[model samples]
Target: MNDQSEQERWNARYADDSYLFGTSPNAFLASQRHLLASGQRALAVADGEGRNGVWLAEQRLHVTAVDFSPAALAKARRLAESRGVEVSFVQADLATWEWKESSFDVVAAIFIQFADPPLREAIFQGIRRTLAPGGLLLLQGYRPEQIQYGTGGPPHAENMYTAAMLREAFRGFEMVSLVEHDSVIQEGAGHHGVSALVDLVARKRA
Candidate 1:
């Protein structure tokens, strides 16, 4: 898909009075809060509607949320203001974004599977470069089995992630934990039901 078209599509989804995904942190992210420290810099990739980013700010993590949709970023800012927490919301396509090396202590990427294989590889590589040494990386993506569940996520198997794929992507990093399982997700109208989940927590070597 064309990058512009993808951005426009997401913007349309976010062009609503309410958040597409309700204003709460992802389950995987909430579970790993203990790994984050107050005042640590965090980056929320494709943080549509700002749910996770706002939650991180509430946890006192200095968060920078990036997405391709202006409409989404606007909603994210509104969510941040309503929560009375400050977060830097940047509108950029992650594929081309100039990810600063060793800039963030935590990189929280929830469910962004819009990239194809080549772009996904670039994104994975950029994710590594963007984190500070020993920085925690929290990620959750749908597994191929999600197609059967029909709860959420892309239909293409290639877009889905596996534990082995994640392990290989961050081979040099400390694999704090990785798991594949099924869980009920009640985030919002967007994603709600029994879903196949792949959760990973890895850290850049210090």
Candidate 2:
């Protein structure tokens, strides 16, 4: 999809009066809170509606939430204010964003599967480069089998993930944990129902 169309699509998705994905953090991300350190620099890639980003701020991470949708970023800002915490939200396309080197101690890449295969590698590499050594990468996405679930996520299988796909995409990280399973996710109207999922948490080599 072209930039304008993609932007408009996401804008409409977030334009809803209710947050598409409730204000709560992702279960996978919240469960791994013990891995986060206080006051670390963090980045929330494609953080729609700011739930994850706001949650990270609550954990004391200085967070920068980046997304192509202005409406989404606006919602994220409101979420931060409502929580009495703060986070920086940037409007930019991950496909071409100049991801700085070793800038963040943590990178949250939950459910950002908009990119195609080629762009997917670029996004993953950018996140890898953006993380400081020993930093953690927390990610979760729908597997290609999600198409069978008839739930949320892109209809295209190419936009979906697989264990081998992510393993190769982020190979050098210390293999902390990676799981592929079936689970019921009830984030909101955007993402709900039993789905094929992949959850990963790994650390960059020091």
The models' CA-based lDDT, in order, is: 0.92, 0.92
Model 1 lDDT tens row, 28-139: 9999988889999999999988999999999999999999999988999988999999999999988789999999999998988877788889999999999999999999
Global fold similarity of model 1 (TM-score): 0.97
Going through the candidates in the order shown, the clash numbers are 0, 0
Q: Using alpha carbons, what is the TM-score of model 2? A: 0.98
Model 2 alpha-carbon miss at residue 51, Å = 0.3
Q: What is the lDDT, from 0 to 100, of the residue 100 in candidate 2?
A: 99
Candidate 1 local Cα displacement, residue 2, angstroms: 3.2
Ten contiguous residues with the weakest lDDT in model 2: 112-121
Query: How do all models score by TM-score?
Result: 0.97, 0.98
lDDT of 1 at 162: 96
- Give the per-residue lDDT digits (tens) of candidate 2, residues 44-153: 99998999999999999999999999998888888899999989989998888999999999999999887888888899999889999999999999999999997888
